[model samples]
Target: MGYNTFHTEGDMEVEVEVEEADQSASSGMAKQAVVENVALANALVKDGGYSWTSPSSLKLYPIIMLITLNTAMNGYDGSLMSSMNAMPAFHDYFNVGKQGPATGLLFAIYTVGQLIGSLFAAPAADRLGRRFGMCSGAFFIVIGTIIQATSKDIGQFMGGRFLIGFGVTVGCTSGPIYVVEVSPPSMRGLFGGLYYSFGYCAGALVASWTCYGTGKMLGDWSWRIPVIIQAFPAAIIFCTVWLLPESPRWQIANGQREKARSFFVEYHGNGNEDSAIVNLQMEEIERETNYDKELANNRWWDYRPLFSTRDRCFRMYLLILVGVFNKFVGGAVISYYLPVILDNIGIKSANEQLLINALNVVFSSVASVFGCFYVDKFGRRNLYLWGALLTGLCYIPMNVIAALAEGHVAKGTGYAFVAFIYLYGIFFSFCWMPLQTLYPAEILPNDIRAQGFAFQELMNGLASFINTYATPIALQRIGWRTYTIFLVLHFIYLGMLWWSIVETKGRSLEELEEIFSDPHPVKKSLEKHKIVLATGQGVKRKPSSNVNDDGFGNGCLNPRNKESLEKHKIVLATGQQSKWE
Candidate 1:
């Protein structure tokens, strides 16, 4: 076959050529990180590089915004519930008499709902398409909100909260996958991470201020209004999801080639079906998916690869650690216990507590917006390493000041502690909030992304449950020492990250698969990342001059070995060849 040279109207031409050669090297050779990176790079980028301001990017931005907006349900539910725990009317109406632990239990039960939702999130996303998965989740949230708004007893209140938790988990988990799968390589960090930053934080911001306003209302409406308001975000997602396109990657994997092609043309290439960019992406998806089927047999239960070898197992731990540390890193403690903490420190006014909560989330939301713009620019390793380091440092002075003013409230120390609290939120917004959702999505392969992401959600739920349930009790007992536990844990987390996690900036989703496949992915990744960042180009393999090209000229970018392609074809043909066999 001859090389195909495809070009867009305002873009440069890209040539894809095929040639025949001896397949000895690739025949017995296993797929590794460096080789995979080369193949993936060939698939994602065209000769004419697509930037953030291109026509395709402009067309795709609004669609990405819609998907990301689903995360608001998560943010709104969390902040609203945290604020409600501080409401005096809420305690009286729900009969939650003077027990602090009882409020903590309510929070813990909500996490249980999240646990249940996460259990089913993987199957739903894999069985149904991404669009339908999100819609199903939003529907659940709407039902849960309705149940909560009219509940008169603790049982009904908890049932409603559980349902909201379940629904939000599904939507939140699905939102990141959709953004990551659909985003262009250059814009992946910004668009893939925008949901956690803009959607979730925006939801929290609205909830915080909404609870403050509703607290002034006379009766049940004080708490019931915010509960009812929770339905709107889920409702918006449910209504609009059917109108959007399915993930192009998902479409290709499920064997919907023509449909996938049309989507890439319309949504990604702005209707330029012949665009070299579209052709390259489609080729990459088909080849990589075919290769994955050969490697893992396309079965969901084959989780052995995740923990079979040292490198793979290490990567799994890193993913789980991200989910765990994100919750336990002191932000959740401060978020749910802020009003209580403030009261103990002499800011005892209920109105002042609500106002502080409102301002904290509002400022945190602004920081998230800023984070979205800078995440790609900063790289994942730097963002996590520095963000964790800086935020952890802020806690030392904060704890010292709180201890100094423990019994008799010093206004200056109290205000100093408040500033530190806000500063902590600012650092967390920049570091964890955006990455919590983005990191796992980037690290996991497409074959196991659904399952891996689900696992992380499970970890996140458990961690959140413990922090929510235990933070109140811990603060009641140790006071400022509650801050000390996280201070130590933060450094431990930073050390683990430094030793293990690799930078995944300026690389496509497919390129990440190669990084994980390498035996020494952490080191190999650092080397590959440097090349991509320095040149704004993907890592390229050294060209062999000895290969003969029968169908394409010397200038054509051809696959080196025809025998390797034949071997790959044979491997694909062996449908159920399990490693265990």
Candidate 2:
């Protein structure tokens, strides 16, 4: 077989691109996986002149599904309070009216707790393992849930909300990092989007229906039951997290090299230590990890590089914008006070509002699933821009219909406003939900992934707090005109995303470093990525034993060991049906 090479490191390097069009001697299970995702066929690499194969994605399903429960736990808490606010029993017990500034503070305090928790999320994840951070968060949620369930006063209930928000901050921030690091490069978008977005929406769906069922009950048990149910997911995560594999990338970063290798082989490689995919993944991780360590700065101050350059600063801006707009545009108002929004649109019955809210979440969850299928396929830029555009356009008619309904200009305008609300959820799910969950983790580098995510959580909490706190006052005063503000803001968000957001689909995490490091990131990202895609080979030089004239070892970045390198070179001789020996 013949192969072409591209120089990856400095000078002393070779990159061979070989298209053998041959089948490898592989197990049935491995071969089956290769047939599924066609992109895996072209990902062959040569290490030390030896051929290597990639790993199967089938092994990733169990852990990805399990970790998503954490995100759903956060989502459940987010919507539960909104649903609870609809019940008269809850209002009577808390002694707070449904539509007022005091009600907004009660809701906003949870976001304050999340903001405080975000301050510690990075340190916890960086020092302890991903599993430990997640379990700790889960434990806190259980404590908070018990307090809320038994709360006798408004202050006690608000305290419970704070704890749940704080605990959820830890889980939501770390959970995505864990998923992104462990997932295969080809499937990161789908898995990340599905678990974070679709999973969260599913939890919201459950909360809506649960409140509907319990709201019909006679006493405080109506709201108390939903508050208590929040603990179940956290408990499941706390109990079973220990059994799951820790993030392989985190293991390697913390100097647990052998453990990292072992897990990569057993879980990612399916017991094949010599698998080409496993070796390439390990090599990339090692190289990046070592490069980051070369700086030797492990303190919180190390994150200064995230804004050292124009490109880096732009990325940070996108992240902050993502956090802010995700909550503010329409989601915060709809999610935190849907009953109030419906009330303004003339849907007077609380039960009717709760049932419609349940259906709205179900539809949004279903739409999120559809978006997940093509998030990677269509790329991030298109989804963000178009999703924002469509969602914004939906509001124009909604605002007009609601405004005209007040003047008795048309009959059944209330139902029209409700339809637009459901449509808004659908559009938001299609565009914003998946990307909001996936982009922050995707854009940040490995060394600062946890820290960057912490910043995002901080912004998310601040924005949610502001929006949740101010939404009730706005709804109480201006009514449907509050939508016009979001409508205008969506256009602003759409323009910024179109102009600044970089596409990250189908690229390796390591490759992204090069893209963002370039001076003209928005312009050069696509161009630089072409080089990475063209080579499709990752090369590392073996260490040499030569001594120099100055009595120092000749340590080169790309070592030249002719004998060892030739020994490592094993060719693929293809027959009528090409296969590896």
Candidate 3:
């Protein structure tokens, strides 16, 4: 029999079919089976009525705002300690001398804490749920900040800073993933960018204000006050996240379809003309079901496929390379060392250095805002390539000035460096910051998205850890030469950006699976051989409907029949040949 079709308010329709059978026993049973199939399909396709009246009507925006707030606190806690280091109380309490190891050690401990936090965030979020993971991290921050506030010695203060770093690490890892999952396809980049942009802005504001207000309060409580202030935000986030919905993707993966549906409707609204939320629950159910079926026998260890073959191996390597290099390319070093760098260049007074640092924050925050506006429009790769280029160019003059000058070079050099720093901040806010935040959320498949991002964060934390401690030592040993090192590193980053990085600007989470499935060869010899076959056949063949040319040379593997499903297993398993055409 032919399939029957029913129309909905939009052009969308549900197609159904029921096969007729003969009166014979076998045929009768077949007929009944067809009837059952028809019934189930009908139910799946039925119009549930518009639950989402308008995009603006959904409560999701408020929830997104909350996540942004939490993210801001993370940024603040992560960078605040850097600015505080210039305070007399912190310098005295820590026994920090100009460009001393103790100074590096104090700041480095926080990154070490972040490393530990990143290692645990994924499994915790997966097993205990996102809310629990977030709250647990927040709790850690509160305790850490409290200790930091009360610490009398450098060791105690280091311990507290580590704790705050650990907590904020969790927020950094989980917050973007959570936000990306809940957002609509069209608004994903905008909302996701907002989280990082606002977070960085708030962080800059905190560091600036804290330094400006308490620069002279060199008593025991001076630096402690900022550390203590972090607790309030943590406390608020800890309590508020409890009321938010667990990720619908996570719920569906755990086989809670009805609950996922309710969440999608309540927060996202039902798929109605007036509602902005299109109920993707049914689509997700089907997609996840297919994914589960495809990987039914797979185990957690199957993640080996991520690095099994040459192509898969290359992709993983590229991701790690970019992540690790991104950190070392002087973002963390600049962030942690900006005040000292300024002071060395003869800004003289601590207050002047603090003011310049504050200006850095303001300019970077503004760049972040502009980045949010154009990220989706310009695409990730465009921003990254140009941003790295501009940032690299900005570093050149600073390095030259430092290398040549005996004292403050010239007033003009200082002006040039200051101008370059703000431009660098803008470039960072627009390109590196948002791109780094968006990459982990968009590059990996659903099953491994959290795990992959955690690993990315681990790399970031490790880099930061090394930079935090090693920066002062490097500066001490190299003196003005440190700028030369960063300048070289930025060029390397520019090369990587032009070569391997893929554009994932406005794609959905489902769409990202396809984007990263195949490797993009940067080397000339391998580029020609990297063509993916549609049906595993060696001969050149027509591209399948599931494969889309993503404007990159390689084909993007669309998740045909699998994008909507919630499966716990990684999408690709070792020993299973890739099915992309």
Candidate 4:
């Protein structure tokens, strides 16, 4: 049977017509038929119905690696400039000394640019296609980096930074969605972790090395050198993007099923073995059409639907808490203002300050490596809880040292303060960084994933904007006591994580929608579709059907109830060739 002749009749059976090939080709045709049947069978079975399997091709990994590198450039641009801001020659050349508000303005304006980019560019990823949106983002980064390298004054420098932030906003917004769409379920968490881990590590490394080298060089070009080096990664990612295949899921969602199937074949390998894999993917895609329908009907302008219902509202509230608290616990303020903070603590030598910053980056890199291996095993909520607690604990001693160092503490306490801060970075890597990246992807339904993430980033950028300026003002007023304020915020964030966040360890995207949805409407909707399948009845039962009112007094499930009316999915994996027509 050729691929085109097969069709499904309801859920019961599939019909295929076997045709004889040329005399020399008959054996090849028989082999192809057998291959298709096995592939189809493996593809159809979900959960324990089929044996476990791995991805058929290695191409998927490189695509993920490139996206990770792309995301890392965002971190590099955001953090590297912070250390440069402290350079003496650069400070005099830009006329920023004694002008605290101007420094704050520079940071705030860049964030404002990022806010605009994330809010606008994210949705286009879904609308225009991932490939086009990502390529455009890379182009912006290259332009922004060039502007920064050539800036003649502070105003020009800020302008360049703003453009860089704008470009990075696309990377932060689209990178997660792209990685999630391309990865298989089993390895999703690991791949996603690698993206953030590498990005953060890159940011830290750039900050450390740039600060050290620029301080030693003792010239105006010291800072310019680091800013210019950023262009290298931007160029490499742009060139490599042409080699990546479009995300198969995105293609499928866009109604390019033939293209998606062909992509799977090209990547998965050519053999009788691949037919089952192709059919299975097709089934999964078929199951997700309703998700696409919901997304299509969503209003782009009004974000109220995200928080309109009980469960969704709860999820929205959780997302907001995570977004704000993640930045508020002092990670952004510390990272962006580390050199200044070190200066205030009596580490006057620029070389010492740069070395300390490098040490902090090293600790964070180690933590990220640990997190990549164990995030799935430990689960999301557990890590958040522990990360928050440890981070809060680390802050207490540092705050105490800061308070006492002014009067009674010895000079060596500066070393203690720096050590505690590095420990804080380690905890942040294991807990907050991973969860910030992981939770946003896990909590939202596919239709709203991009928008939900955009909102999260908006809040994060807003918090960071406040912190960027607020840290300097706080330091001017409180000296070292600012660490105490962070201590209190970390505890507050810990409580929120323990009480509100839900576990989403192994759930598929559809199952996640049901698990997090209001059970009542979901139950009512699923009941209507109960007759669609017999074998998968048990599968349906696993999804929670209870609906509850959103705490804000709105129903979480839409009263329209369109999902229940959808047809049951037909599972068709290939097996040994049969004589029946």
lDDT (CA) per prediction: 0.70, 0.71, 0.62, 0.62
- Per-residue accuracy of model 3 over 276-384 as CA lDDT, tens digit each: 2233334644474567456442343344645544544555666686678877767776677877776666665777777777788888888787788677666667787
Instruction: Identify the runs in model 1 with alpha carbons over 4 angstroms from their true place.
Output: 1-47, 51-54, 97-99, 295-305, 308-311, 529-581
Put the candidates in TM-score order, highest first.
1, 2, 4, 3
Ranking by lDDT: 2, 1, 4, 3
Poorest 10 consecutive residues by lDDT, candidate 2: 29-38
Q: TM-score of the candidate numbered 1?
A: 0.84
Number of clashes found in candidate 4 = 20
What's the C-alpha lDDT at position 480 in model 2? 69
User: Residue 539 of candidate 2: its Cα lDDT?
Assistant: 17
TM-score of each: 0.84, 0.82, 0.78, 0.78
Query: Which is the winner by TM-score between candidate 2 and candidate 3?
Result: 2
RMSD from true fold, candidate 1: 9.3
